[model samples]
Target: MEQNPPKSIASIKEKLKKSREREEECATNLQLLRQDLIKARTAAIDVVMAHQKAVVKLDEELEENAKDLKNVHVHFLSEREALLSSFVGSLLRKEKATGKTPPQPDAPRFVAPLHTPTILCFLRTHLGKPGMLYCGRKVLECEDFMLKTNRERMELLFAQHRCFGCFLPLSVAGHLKLSDCPHPRYCAICDSKDHHQILCAARRVYQGVIPE
Candidate 1:
């Protein structure tokens, strides 16, 4: 028989082969792990990018909603002004047809019958010349429920009128009627749109309403 290979050498060779196989298996496992990590990182990046895009879209939608809300508010205010103007015009037309002298805005005495119209007047003092400005009459005394208190009725009447300054006609709507003025809706002390002459508390006050 051929001389047998040295036992020690045979054992050493077997161990070397086993170690190489184990190294190859480890290398394969390491490569697979590296590939798995790369995939995981790529998926995480995609998720972050999607989240960022969604956030940007949400902000844009919110901005659009805000603009729509602002537009609605402006529209509502404009419509309210138009309605008030239209109501005043209607009253003026009624007066013209009846040939009745509607209650003057500056008259001190609140002498309007139920459902009678009261004119709101404005004076353009800033136009280099003091000119009388009048808006169409707005109806003050409506044939509605009888108010209980004098103060309540007075407040309601005041609410129907407006005065601009210590001396302005055609006040914005909702001026308080001055008790001291000759005209029903005018201020005697200060031609203001909101308060009585006594309560006007202005440094300068108008003495009386201009003669019609």
Candidate 2:
């Protein structure tokens, strides 16, 4: 019985040692799992920050691109106005030199019905200071209704382009038509919803340099 008691005690001590080793193994595994979890969280934070930085850079590039496009449009309109004014002036001078009455200019028609009318015609027919009878009323008065109809048509065209004012893509603020303002329109700089570009302060600054 004494010998049997020692053997039983030895068996118990061996089991206890094995149990302690298992507990230590479990604790080491738990520590490794915690370390992995912390690394995952840190990596996720870094990814998010990198994504945000990329988005900011993209936005800045888009804004710069829009500004460049606006400048190009401005320059093109100025050149177009100068060319037209020169052509018209030359025609008038030639007629006066020949001692012949200058025939009234007619607005040139467009080949595509969907396109905006020639700028010269819109200026002569819709914005002329002198009154000429057309369909019982003055030409300008008669063309007012036509201009409004054309304005609606131009909305879709404007939608395809960016806004000159905010240098962003054009939004629901109804597409501003070139006919709504004077020649070489400065609609991009004007903020007034009620007034045309002719009344804009920015427009006035460049008044005489560009033809009307």
Q: In terms of TM-score, which candidate is strongest? A: 2
Query: lDDT tens string, model 2, 62-129?
Result: 99997777656555554554465456567767988999996654854212222222322222233445
TM-scores across all candidates? 0.47, 0.48
Find the 10 residues in a row with the least total lDDT in model 2. Answer: 109-118
Instruction: Report the CA-based lDDT of candidate 2 relative to the real structure.
Output: 0.48
User: Which pairs clash in the backbone of model 2?
Assistant: none
Candidate 1: stretches off by over 4 Å: 1-5, 106-212
Question: Number of backbone collisions per candidate, in order?
Answer: 23, 0
The segments of candidate 2 whose C-alpha lies over 4 angstroms from its true place after superposition are 97-99, 106-212
